[model samples]
Target: MPGRSPRRSTPQPATCRTCWGGSDSGPAFDAYATAWEADAKTLTDALHELADKIRASKGAYGGSDGLVSTQAARVRVGDGTVSTMPAYAERPSALASY
Candidate 1:
């Protein structure tokens, strides 16, 4: 990021001549980004499908309990102290829904 090239450089030229003649580079960049976006979107869709299949086929360790529950505790070790956030418990009233 430090040495990144600025978006626009050179005197008030209408276009960059490196990609296209007459110093115009907008079209080249736009085309490249369009193709890249399409490819990335395709890969993202595939990954999502794989994740969904795995999720659907998951056993008891699915998302329902994937998150570990914890109870509040005070801990100290080697003169160091740390406070941890304990997981919340379902209120007694909520059990009636089962």
Candidate 2:
């Protein structure tokens, strides 16, 4: 007995049921349900807010890309045979040496 550890008893289902007021329709169940619902709503609202931010960022990136493309289209570099000219103007070749 001096070298032996004390044994611990595990609670049965009845013991657990009794602790929660003995049935499903109890104060403990009601409190748990209310807290769960509140937590779910808070999570849903945060997700929606995050989605809106992502959409706005996507639109901003798209607009910036369009503006850059438009500006790039207006720039032109000359080939060795001619002086520099706008991209919209006619040139001997589409490629430039410098």
Candidate 3:
């Protein structure tokens, strides 16, 4: 990315009165500008979709439910059994259903 212009630069034809103004590579400039616009739009849309998926997946595992699931699993190593434990106990919540 060294020496590359940032994509946020205005997307205009080579002769549009900016750094590219008076340059003879007008067609090449137009091609780059058009590609940048398309790529920027695609990146924006993909980011929005990723954010929505993250928001939807929240809270599926946490608190007491998560702790119970972990404690039930056993791992064997060198003829020894080890069980997973939560780092901290789940806090009591008045709103929590028993």
lDDT (Cα, tens digit) per residue for candidate 1, span 1-98: 78998696664434444535544476666788999999999999999999998877785566445454322233335456555856579667866888
> Over the stretch 7-35, how does candidate 3's per-residue lDDT look in tens digits?
87656653374455556467677799999
Arrange candidates by lDDT, highest first: which order? 2, 3, 1
Whole-model alpha-carbon lDDT for candidate 1:
0.67
Candidate 2 on 4-36: residue-level lDDT in tens? 999988877667677656766456777999999
Per-candidate TM-scores read 0.39, 0.48, 0.39
Candidate 2 contains a number of clashing pairs equal to 0
Task: State, as a TM-score between 0 and 1, how close model 3 is to the true structure.
Answer: 0.39
Off by over 4 Å in 1: 1-24, 60-98
lDDT of each: 0.67, 0.82, 0.73
Best by TM-score: 2
Model 2 CA lDDT for position 5: 92
Clashes per candidate, residues 3 or more apart or on different chains = 4, 0, 0
